[model samples]
Target chain A: MAEMRREWIVNAVLAMALLIVPLVALWINEPFYVTLATRVAILALAGVGLNLALGLGGMVSFGHAAYFGLGGYVAGIMAHHAFTGLPMWIGVTGSNQMLWIWLWAALLSGFLALIIGALSLRTSGIFFIMITLAFAQMIFYFTLSWPAYGGEDGLPIFVRNQFPGLNTMRPWDMFILSYGVLMLALVFFAMLRAARFGAALMAIRQNPDRAAAVGISPFGVKLAAFVLSGMITGLAGAMMADLTRFVSPAMIAWQMSGELIVIIILGGVGRLFGPVAGAAILVAFEVIFGGITEHWQFFLGLILLGVVLFARGGLIGLLAGRARHG
Target chain B: MSVALFAEQLLNGVQFGLMLFLMAAGLTLVFGVMGLINLAHGSLYMIGAFVCAAAAAAFGSFWLGLIAGLAAAAAAGALIELTVIRRLYDRDHLDQVLATFALILILSEGVRMIFGPFPLYLSVPDLLRGTVDLGITRYSLYRLALIGIGIAVAIGLWLLIAKTRLGIQIRAGESDREMIAALGVNIRWLYTVVFALGAALAGMAGALVGAIQSVQVGMGEPVLILAFVVIVIGGIGSIKGAMVGALLVGVIDTMGRFLLPRIFAAFLDPAQAMGVGAALASMLIYLLMALVLILRPRGLFPAHG
Candidate 1:
């Protein structure tokens, strides 16, 4: 019980720090820090999306960036058309509304995940990893080929899209929006972990044959988790596109997928706040080391190697305790 | 297409397939023997190309450079295996993936720091630069030499794996690591040897390719991706599958590029045809992969019983 309390304390402190650091930055007139915090929150959201599959479900998808890039493309393509006053298809025009845009992004990514998951779930282990990666590469190449939408150069958003009451152009507002969404995602992730379906997913992860013996369909459960995971990632991608005001094939690239995995492993794979801690560490490293040298990634790789080899539990694990399930 | 053009593209496809086989061979061998999903295999390929280019430039001898590339890559492979990969033999696939992925970042950046950001040129040797005529068409001898090298390597590998005692130990290790170790085979040294061998092959492919294109950091990733597709289509841990799959992918990709544009031109406006055809052609390999996966989920040749 005492150990559990410590874990809770660590989790609370991490969450509060995430919130307070940005607010302090805003107060100190360091808007750049606020932007950094926003990046952490948005990336954390994407990581959480992946954690759903990787952590809880034991599905190590190397292509969450597909859903992520799709989400960003949705935002970029919509805003681009909106700016040009052009129709997206036959009769539908582009939307600048965040609510509608987020909904569509989730839907599209979920749909793609369904198709990809159906095919990929047929295989297990290394084959699954390669197939997910290959599918992402397919999307990456598709975007690169379409010269109409900026091709490899990527598309840019001239203006930030609107929210119901917030002025998203302001740095703090965007940060706040991203934080709120991240918090909501955390709550949803926690609920799913506690829910019955989460149990089924976990069961499948632990032992598929046993899960089958219990009458739970392993394929269905995994597929559902994959879609939900993709949707969350897609929503995060949409916000990320808004934060950067740009979307390119880079968003969907395999490197993006690798980065997402790095953050999850850096923080704590299954922990609720793992993404938050990871994104914080990653962005912090990027800032500090980036300022020091052009080859910051070399050091990042070294540190990451150390963590994977020695530091198994990540930041949350180091601070809190062994992961609950682990 | 003219008969000459058709023949030329056919040879190009075969040549491209051979290059892919070098990469796939290594990847499949490693996965089959070690159960390691190495993302940094591509980085080793990059290392080979860089070393080959730098050595050839310094010594002014391409042949000497090739020898240096193979040796350096093999040494680097053994070093990495001893230092990092040996620990990961027991870890899950995710850890292996992440560790190798990190290796790629470190190695690529390390190479960039050493060689700078620009690509280095590695010209084909003078002896292999001339064109060769075969019936209706002429093709570059350098490319044909690459094809010959790939075939020679393939046969050499087959003999090495099928005819040697080390090959028997390797095959035994693949099916049962403990049994081989129990039989007094040095499992540790065997793994190192296997890894080094795989790395050497990938490096050789990189050195060959570097003569045609500029040697640069991150050059191995695309080939690595394609190699992954090849192994998946061929079957993980199956050398025969890798070779067959490589050829199929190579031929299909080359032919798609050559034919798709013409097919589109026949039906669409000339200007539109070129654009749409190029786009579709670029995606043809992936589409083929997806189609194959749908039909054969375990791939065309799964190795395990």
Candidate 2:
């Protein structure tokens, strides 16, 4: 196919995969698959958030799981307190359930981003990566030790928190909530990419000193991108907690953060739909091979190594030939 | 816990530090010589423990198993260097991190698939199993023995690198990779050999530590983090830094964990004290790391010059 036609084909295929597949899965006789797809959607949303900082901004944060987990704990704690009859101070009429949970998740995650990014942004290169990882470890260890929550055992959501006119306890309702969040996150990603701030962020990633030479403050640009990236991951965490009806210290674990990076790579690094595609592949592999073999991670590792070694641009890069385009 | 308890903990801290040295020596050596970070160094450790455990079980000989484990791990390291890792020398750190991360996943799962998820135990050899009655206190003979072994290894490694022709080539490579290659040393062999040596050291650590702790999949991860911390504190490419940093971190971390709860209990209730104390203890080394980086970004013993 010609270049333009091939690009169109790639975009259409992705849309169909992202949109049509989930809807089809929802319609199918299997309730299990819809729920599975919803998990993918939520995880993909988290990855989309990560892709902003990592793929575009060139910040490989191994600490995003902190935001994702913290967002979860926020919702989990709020619901726990609310269920236990603690009166929330602000009594806005519509801000009763899911929206408030998500809003607070975004805000708290952003706040975390501000603190973590501020300290970490001081260092560059491998120092930055290790610092971020260490900070996340700090949070993880804190959660594990803090006994107010379930500690290592994790906190369970006995009743799915209420959403007006929606029975969120039901899997279908939960899937819709997660899918909606994923779509909104994707739109946010696209808009940010097109925005001038996004261009500036990209420029910072390419060469901060040079970008500064051109009068762009790399510091503020990176900080903004980090905050936005963190907030989105945070929202995904909230959704994840809702899906699982539980929150654990593991959500903030380095493994989760590393896995998020993995998804971006598997799909095709820096592509808009890369995270979604990557999440799809990972979740699908988990669902299928997990049933057949108990040790599927080994195979996943092999594939990942192959991708890193040979498929430098990732799956989408191979399919679309967007190296020069980028 | 009395002064004696503190003393024991100190010794434990030293023992742990020695173990960390064994782990970090190879890692630092490989990284120092070739600016490539190998995330799978932990996997090599895991491989060592697994091999030793399996071999010991089959042969009813712990010493033989340990030798087999070391050799297997070293061989695997060499193979990996030749097949996959050597190519990654020129690649960026992010690429290296990802690829190595992938290897960890593969290794842990592979071990699990083969050996099952159950943790394996390797009994200590007859000579090293008992405790030694020191003048001041009783100590695990094996632990003391490990300290001796670590010191010996450190000396041997120093001599090898400082005295031997191969060691000179490695030193030359570290100083200048392109120039060393131009001078007719087989750079690839140096890398493969260094990688193998590192893998062997890691395997030794795993086998030794496996005597103390159960051998399980993903066991290498925590050690890997600490090794990273060690390298960071000591300086990325310095052997001396790894040694010093490992000891400092081991002592500080152990002391912090043991002492913090007591400090906190004076100010708060027992329950809150434990929680706060543990959290602070966990954060201490990291806090130290941040402070060190702030003061000296190249690390405490950077070999950059």
Candidate 3:
């Protein structure tokens, strides 16, 4: 119980820091710092998405980038058509409303996850990892070859998508919107972790046979978790595309998927604020060490190796102690 | 397509498949024996290419470079096994994946630091350069040599695994690790040897391929993923499966790219057909993999049973 209280305090501090730092940057007129904070929030949201499956549900999906990239494409394609005043298909037109794009991004990625998860969940262990990877590669290659929307070059959104009463063109406004979504996602993640479904999902993750014996249908629970996980990550992708003002196949690359996993592991799997901490640390490392030398990734690799070998519990684990449950 | 064109494409497919087999064989061997999925296996491939390119340039001998590439990869593999991978054998797949991924960042950056950002060039040996006249059509001599080398390696691997005393120990180790150790077969040494052996094959493939393609940093990543796809389709830990899967992926991928656009053009406009067919062609191997998994979840050849 003491540990629980400590964790909550840590989470609260992390959340406040994420918001206040960006606000401070905006007040100081440092748009670059604001952009960096926005990146942390958005990436943390994506990490939160993966945390649902990886930490809580024990599905180490290596292909979350597929959903992330798919969401970006959704945002990019819609904004592209809206800007050009062109029809998307036959009767359908493009939408520049952030809300509509978010809905479609979530829905489409959720649907994709349904199919991929259904197929992938059939296998477990290393097979599951590779299959997820292969599926993501399938999407990556498709996007690379299909030249309609820039192909390998990628698509760009000339104007930021509109939000109600907010000029998203301003970096501060965009940071506010991103930060708000991240907070909502963190709340949703916390709620889901405490829900009946989360318990069943975590139960299945611990022991599938026992989970099945308890009449909780392992397949159904995992599939649902996977879909929800993909949807959250997808939402992050949409926001990321908007933040960058461009969408490319690089978004779907395997490295992006790897980075997402790295974030979850670095933050502390299953911990609520793990993603937020991981993203902040990762970005900080990139900026700090990157400024030092061209070969900063070498040091980054060494640190990650140390983390995997010695610090399995990640940053949160180091600070808050082992997870309360399991 | 004309018969000659078809024949040429088929040979290209075979050649590509053969190279893939070289990569998959080592990958499967490592997985079969160690139960470790080394993402850094691809880094070994890159090392082979870079070292071979550098050696060839220094010595002005492709043959010397090939040998040097193989030795360097094998040595690197053994070193990594002793320091990093040995610890990971008892760990779960997730840890193995991350550790090896970290190794990739380290190794790739290390190589870049030495080799700089630009790609290195490796020309084909004089003996393998130029075209050869087959009965049906002319083909690149270097490609034909690659096909020959691939077949030879496959046969040699089969013989080694089936006939040699070391092969018996390897088979035993795969089926029962503790048993082999208990039998005083020196399991630790065996693992290092196997890792080096696998790394050598990957390196050889990289060196050979480097002669044809530009040798650059991150070059092995695409091949690595494809090799993963190959091993998955072939069934993990099965060399025969790796060979078959490699061939299937290589042929289907090459032929799909070659034929899909023309097939689409039969009905759709050429421009649209080209775009659509190219997209589908790129996805064709993965679709094949998905279908295979649906039909046989454990892959075509489950190693255990």
**Chain A: TM-score in each model:** 0.99, 0.93, 0.99
Better of 2 and 3 by lDDT: 3
DockQ, structure candidate 3: 0.83
Off by over 4 Å in 1: none
Model 3 residue B186 CA deviation (Å) reads 1.2
Residue-by-residue lDDT tens digits, candidate 2, A142-238 = 8888777788999887777777778987777777778777877878888888899988988888888999999999889998899999999999998
Model 2 misplaced stretches (Cα beyond 4 Å):
A1-9, A86-96
Give each model a TM-score. Answer: 0.98, 0.94, 0.99
What TM-score would candidate 3 get against the native? 0.99
Report lDDT (Cα) of residue A298, candidate 3. Answer: 90
Q: Which lDDT tens digits does candidate 1 get at residues B76-170?
A: 89999999999999999999999999999999999999999999999999889889998799999999999999999999999999999999988
Each model's DockQ?
0.78, 0.57, 0.83
Best of the candidates, DockQ: 3
For all candidates in order, the CA lDDT equals 0.92, 0.85, 0.93
lDDT of 1 by residue, A177-294 (tens): 9999999999999999989999999999999999999899999999999999999999999999999999999999899999999999999988888998999999999999999999
Candidates sorted by TM-score, best first: 3, 1, 2
TM-score of 1: 0.98
Q: How many backbone clashes does candidate 2 have?
A: 0
- Over B200-256, each residue of candidate 2 has an lDDT whose tens digit, in order, gives 999989988888899998888778778878888898878899999899988999999
Residue pairs clashing in model 3 are: none
